[model samples]
Target chain A: MSTTGTAWTPERRARAALTFICEPGRPDLSRFVAEQGAPDVVEALLASSGTAAWSRRARCLDLDALIARAEALGARLVVPGDDEWPAPLAELDRIEPVGGMCGAPLALWVAGRRRLDEILRPGYGALAIVGARACTRYGQALATDLASRLAGQFPVISGGAYGIDIAAHRGALAAGAPTVAVMAGGLDEWYPKGNTRVFEQILDEWAVVSELPPGMRPTRPGFLARNRLIAALSAGVLVVEAAMRSGAVNTAHWAGALGRIVMAVPGPVTSGMSETPHRLIRDHEAELVAGPADVRALLCAPGEQLEGPWMTPTRPLDGLDPRLLAVREALPGRGSLTVDQLASRARCTSAACDGALVELELLGLVEQDESGRWRLRRPR
Target chain B: MSTTGTAWTPERRARAALTFICEPGRPDLSRFVAEQGAPDVVEALLASSGTAAWSRRARCLDLDALIARAEALGARLVVPGDDEWPAPLAELDRIEPVGGMCGAPLALWVAGRRRLDEILRPGYGALAIVGARACTRYGQALATDLASRLAGQFPVISGGAYGIDIAAHRGALAAGAPTVAVMAGGLDEWYPKGNTRVFEQILDEWAVVSELPPGMRPTRPGFLARNRLIAALSAGVLVVEAAMRSGAVNTAHWAGALGRIVMAVPGPVTSGMSETPHRLIRDHEAELVAGPADVRALLCAPGEQLEGPWMTPTRPLDGLDPRLLAVREALPGRGSLTVDQLASRARCTSAACDGALVELELLGLVEQDESGRWRLRRPR
Candidate 1:
């Protein structure tokens, strides 16, 4: 019989065949495979003493068709000993089960121009940006901005779905950076047809990955299994926005159980989209990150400062005279105001307010409009 | 010599006199007063041994005039060992100085019908709400709502300034509960003038307190000293909204220094007004409180649940099937959508979407308009 490629050793073939018959994230099956080896586990499942369901699926599987489908999609199966396997996934073997699901994927079907191993090596790691599929505009904008800014340094990774996930993918593409799309089903058909364009763009530069074989549709259990893979493949996971009950929260759970840095961006407490992020932060289960700088701060080694423009404590109005500060605060956020109006609002004399405006203008903190009204200068 | 009232002992008079000549928060002076006693300290300052600034101010002091001024304002002095002095202020005596300011006031000038001691006794501790004077409508609204909800159980404490401070004071009064306004200047005249009406209302029910005498005006340093008193008088400090450099941040520092629970409400990250609160929450320096219930949770003894409607983890969408959840999430936040639109958005077939919608409708998670378009039910 013809094989998929020279890289398809007996071990690789066994792992690939197991993906078709055995479900992913089964801790007991994973343990059995780990101790006895994939080939031996497959042999046991095919024997008379094996579970009826596993034996039936094992016997009916068509290996040749699976191999041909993988090749047709430009995907390759990577097993435990392959050079392309992610080192971070090793953590999955040691972590406790979540929702009765645990263990590293038996083999991942990966397709891309770049290697997964190189993308997730030490010093250069991936960050997973996951959130609700029905995200708000604020959440989408923030996720896109954060991903675009960080993708050039660390490749962005996310599920191939809409809302925050698609936005993150588009952001990386906008920045001309590579990004990975970890799908919940067979990557041959990027599940959400709406984001197929984004998936295609990602596949051109980075990769589309999954644990399932071709021709399989995504199930609810498959989605849970996919979240674990996303978490295990990244150094840290940043939850942009999520509801009280969301898949993003589940991904965060997996990240936490894997000992990965779990960070969340805060939005208005008034928004339902902020529920999961706020809950994570309030419970101390995740670090609060306002932007990319905060994410960098937590991901970096201890004692290293998060170096960015925002890291500086030098605010424009810091250390201003109390009178000047009061005058500045009195000015409305949008419109300009006359000295008299400012003084009335600031509760100071008009002369003092005028003097403060002059000083503030000199310091580049305020400006005079054509109408002779003073306003705060926009900060650079 | 004529005295303010029977409560004005020689020791009380000495403490009262010190307020006229000395600034409120001098760590060294506070240590001196603590050790030497207020009467001896006054005599020493009156003698040639006093510093030039202290001696000049002390020598010209007229006891009868001060006493008469106190009675005319309907205010009285509450010295250490007095029944009306807040026991929480004792914490200030043991805490380290922040920015060269420390220790409790020698005596507080207070005005109101309720005894300060009774209001701040063990069971009925106060919460301080502080923020920017030029706060956003969001901040002001949140402050008002939080204070109104919490004041019935806990007397609200705040500064008598224009924005968040006055809003908090007004909210407490709206609840028909007594609230304290800690002033930077003297209680006899509330500064800023814009908030005098609110201050007058507070005096009718609660109290206005300060360390300065009747003739003193608020200076920059006096504002810093006033922050410590607000922190010292409360069980916790809730910063509603503040810029990066704000007096509210200063109060949070005092609260932290005094080991008081420091909590902050989160707003939109796009707003500059949220800077201080976001920073405090990100650095783990302050707990994030979305509402009064969160405040109650932190203030309660460890392990006690924050008992409120929000405390229940039974969300409307909890334990929902994946198909129904997807359909629910697909419905637009505001408007209704056709079945085809939802099915397309949820990446499900029209038949499956229709079935899921029926289940969701039965569960009261979604509703259909007269047009037969489905929409998510607004969470109550």
Candidate 2:
């Protein structure tokens, strides 16, 4: 039985066989498939002598047996033309290989009750929340909160690793929102073993996606290849906490290369985990995101404002009365000035200045020091 | 007795009277001083009718008495032409007024053991480290460490307030380096009585300077006016920690307006004190600085690097061995790949890949996962 349509076409079955034969992100194979089509490329590889890596790898593959194993594990092979395939993955075809890895997967072994296209639709995109597996408590908390807040508006996508990733998925699940786990291994095996429960929960409600066929163990290259998928699939990638050299930073680089927004949450400079975020922000590689509102503001369309429940209404200073606005402007951006000093600068009488200060104080627009000086209140 | 030269000139005496009569940074008086010269402007103001603010204020001044009082308080008057006057203050004369305050002080009433000119010279320019008076313990510690680290190369300049300022001065003093306190009020009366001991220590070892004459109290405007002096006196301004509306941010603005390097140390975002630093860094108004090395790197002329004591030598990745570099380039920026996976990507035999991995691991260029996969080590 075909999972994508009424029946699997020759091209679709060939693409499925190619996934088992060639490793994910083989640029040579992808170029061949793009130029000659999957069925032609598969036939050429299978019939060739042991001259190329693909031919040697394909010689041992039992295509029918591999397809049967995927079906038995309740996985569906979704190729590029499938209705369940995410459209954003097509962007990967244009990216030059990074670390000898490039191009869209030949076929995705997807296991979930939900459809991938519906979860990652046009307006409702996915946000990849990723960070160090050994992240600090602060990093974990920020990742969780950010994911939970954005989950309703967008699917929270992440690798199913410990620390930040687990926290993000759990946060989305706790909010009863769909979250996707883009794994480095096959759909049948949970790589970390420690996160088996989280993987099970994601499988129950969301999707666990892989490029490899059933029972194939995760390789280091597979994880790096997997990062590109996470970057391509999401509208933006938010690095909550990472060391100076981390996989999260790698993901951010991929996001940037793909022209996606790369944002990072800042932490104390003293923590080793905060180094990547600080460096990214300092080098202008990533924008600094304080909370969910900042993330929403960056990702959403200009006129489409989505205020999270946790965000406070930001009252614009321009809405204040002209006199009050003048008074506020006269106050030093830092430090205090007395009413008389403020009056002279604000071009008003002492009485008028005093009245404005009182009104401003009542509105929490200004504050008075112990020495009876006035200054603008800092907006939260 | 004169501190700067053989004897104080009549022009110097005129400037001293101007400081007592006109408030610091009055653009009208500053313009008058700039156009007519300090002595001529002082004469004109004292002789004129009560129309303009400067003339009205000047009419009541006892110029001789004010000079006598300053001398009696062991304070020497330093005019623009005096050797003791810091050259950087000239930038103030060119700055367009901010909040009705601008221009160089007519004269500074200085009281200290160390000479002002010697402490704030061209090659050994001062660094202004300012922050919140109500700062956190973390802020205080950072202020102290940064001050102490830079003290050997640069004199520390700050307002002698209760929190960050006092800590900065104490840190510099502990390092046995000269520190300058640019106070708002006269040197005779320490503004904040609580910081009297620190002020005494500073006066005994360094310098306590003010635009206001002896016995005059600090007005709210005087403090605001003093901030510009702090900004103008330094080569750069490093905001350690500040609230949203802090004097440190005001100082940073002045530094920016005067084309000085403005730097800020990042702290935990959860703290209210970090708001100003984060805002400055986030807005690109200030460069992010974690320690003295960053400060040195920014302030030093291009190719005139001064390595800080705490800085570590950074090795360039391009300097690695050829085969090792090839293996490194083959590794994904994030995640791992097994020996076989790596060999295929590196275009080398499995045995060659294993040898390179061992060499790379020894060099701390790469690390192995629990599954014996290899990945590049993130550089600090």
Separate DockQ for every predicted complex: 0.47, 0.34
lDDT of 1 by residue, A250-272 (tens): 99999999998999888887889
lDDT (Cα, tens digit) per residue for candidate 1, span B116-218: 8756766555789999998999999999988888876667899888899999999889877668999999776679898888888888777888899887899
Global lDDT scores for all candidate models: 0.83, 0.82
Q: Which stretches of candidate 1 lie over 4 Å from their true place?
A: A1-6, A47-51, A303-380, B1-5, B49-51, B303-380
Q: What is the C-alpha lDDT profile of model 2 across B156-232, one tens digit per residue?
A: 99999878998999988888777899989987778798888888888788788999998789998999899999999
Which candidate achieves the best lDDT against the true structure?
Answer: 1
Each model's TM-score, in the order given? 0.78, 0.78
Candidate 1, DockQ score (0 to 1): 0.47
Any runs in candidate 2 off by more than 4 Å, and if so which?
Answer: A1-6, A51-53, A306-380, B49-56, B123-125, B307-380
lDDT of 2 at B348: 91
* Model 1 Cα shift for residue A217 (angstroms): 0.9
